[model samples]
Target: EETHPVIIAGFGHFGNTVGRFLRANGVNATYLDIDSDRVALLRRMGFKVYYGDASRHDLLRAAGAAHAKLLVIAIDNVEKRLEMIETAKKHFPNLHLYVRSRNRFDAYELLNAGMLHVYRESLDTSLRMGVDVLKMLGHDAYHATRMSKMFLKYDEKNLKKLAAIEDREAYILEARTRMEELERILQEDTNNRLMLQVDAAWDDASLIKEATQQATAQTE
Candidate 1:
């Protein structure tokens, strides 16, 4: 079998973007898809995509899963995605799995199953839309951007905490408490005059760093 640094299981819109970005950056990846039509279309566009069910152990082995450093699971079907995760974890223990989750619940399932890297498909885009809505409502661009960064950081951290709770009623209670805490913290930040004194341009890295630090300090 041929060896590759990465193996992507699906070639849909989400997986396509990932594949394109990796290829553009000089990274070689083995692509697999269950849709023959989609695979043909991608092949016509100069992409080397294999047609097969990625959840199958033999297909993954043939696609170089043994030596691949990362496995990007961007498949659409939830059941199939979970099946593929199980298959990968069972046979390719050395491969790091980067999973695409449909929502928070999906992420929780993946987390419970020991998947470390789970990207919720709509989280970042939804936050971006919120930032734009705030800007259109006469809020300062930098402030809106910073608020969104903080929200993202808080929600992600909260996701992990909520995921660990197995009891349904307990999870609901904790979730409500977390939501109230988030509102109180955001309100406090809004009232802080010192936080509004910054007049710098939008820097994503700095905003994310500040948000992470702020979240860490609050939890301490």
Candidate 2:
């Protein structure tokens, strides 16, 4: 068995990106996947992927779970992902877990299970799209970016609150209330021109400089 600093289960699209970024930064991770075809393909492509179910205790131990500092759960199946979390926690109590959640509902289960590092797979991408739409509608690039950041912060905070409610009807009602509150707060911010203020890190001068350079290049 080889020792790895990071053990990533599920070498699919989500896990692949995480593994790639870590590899690019000079970090080596042990990758595990249930899909034999994908595992073989990745091996041919130079990725060190082991074919096995990560939810299994034996496979985790073989992957150096006892010594690995972090375990990333990026599997697509919700039930299997939760099972992996349980197995890892029971066997390697000290290993940090980074989980990939399908959505807010999936996130609630992970949160309820006491997992701290949960990544909602599509939240960031969806927010990025919202920012792009704002920019396309002639909003300031910096302002749009700031709004997205604010929205993410608000949504994350609200997710935790909503996750605690067990009743479906109660959850739906609270979710609706939160959505309305978010809309009102954003409206208030717009009316107050809070988002219009320039951020020093992304000031208008830099944007103007970039635009001027583009225009200059076009005429040349």
Candidate 3:
């Protein structure tokens, strides 16, 4: 029987936050990090974590790699991330890896390897924080986080959906609808920063126009 469990590798900012967030939500997770100090700190903080490199077969196996469900590669190093991915996919064939990539190239590599859930770490959170700062001094941690998550889902869906159609006017119409939906959401959520709201409006309009033009040009 496979004892699948959420496994977080690399105890940097990304990994630490993931572990803490999961634990706060009452989800059990194990941490694998090469930093001895971080491992010790997390262990002292009562988290199930250990010091080790994830790219090594023995270390991953010891970390229950065979039965691990979700593997989060939160490390900053591009090389290390690839190594971990290769090892995990090769050894733990069933593991679903959620990788944090530095840029589009890294994302492409991960995607080429059949790793889907790749995140551009810090980009979303930083954007949300910037929006919050622009809106006002008021910060509601929970609401901000929730709104950010919603925004990401909406943005990702729109971006991917827009890429499929070859019609310029159709793409523009779809983008306009998305903007309207964003505005409606912004109005409904008091947590949204006013500056962000304004920025989103203009940004969405510009994006819609550009997409429409590009699609039109491509088809012609």
Best by TM-score: 2
Clashes of each: 0, 0, 0
Per-residue C-alpha lDDT of model 3 across residues 96-180, encoded as one tens digit per residue: 8899877644565666667778786656867677667745767666666667777777765655555555577997898789878
TM-score of each: 0.85, 0.85, 0.61
How many Å off is the CA of 162 in candidate 3? 12
How would you order the candidates by TM-score, starting with the best? Answer: 2, 1, 3
List the lowest-lDDT window of 10 residues for candidate 3: 156-165
Off by over 4 Å in 1: 193-220
Candidate 2 lDDT over residue span 34-92, tens digit each: 99999999999999999999999999999999999999999999989989998999999
Ranking by lDDT: 2, 1, 3
**Candidate 2 lDDT trough over 10 residues, lowest sum:** 194-203
* Model 1 Cα lDDT, one tens digit per residue, 27-80: 989999999999999999999899999999999999989888999999999999
The residue pairs in collision within model 2 are none
RMSD of each: 11.5, 8.7, 15.7
**TM-score of predicted model 2?**
0.85
**Collision pairs in model 1:** none
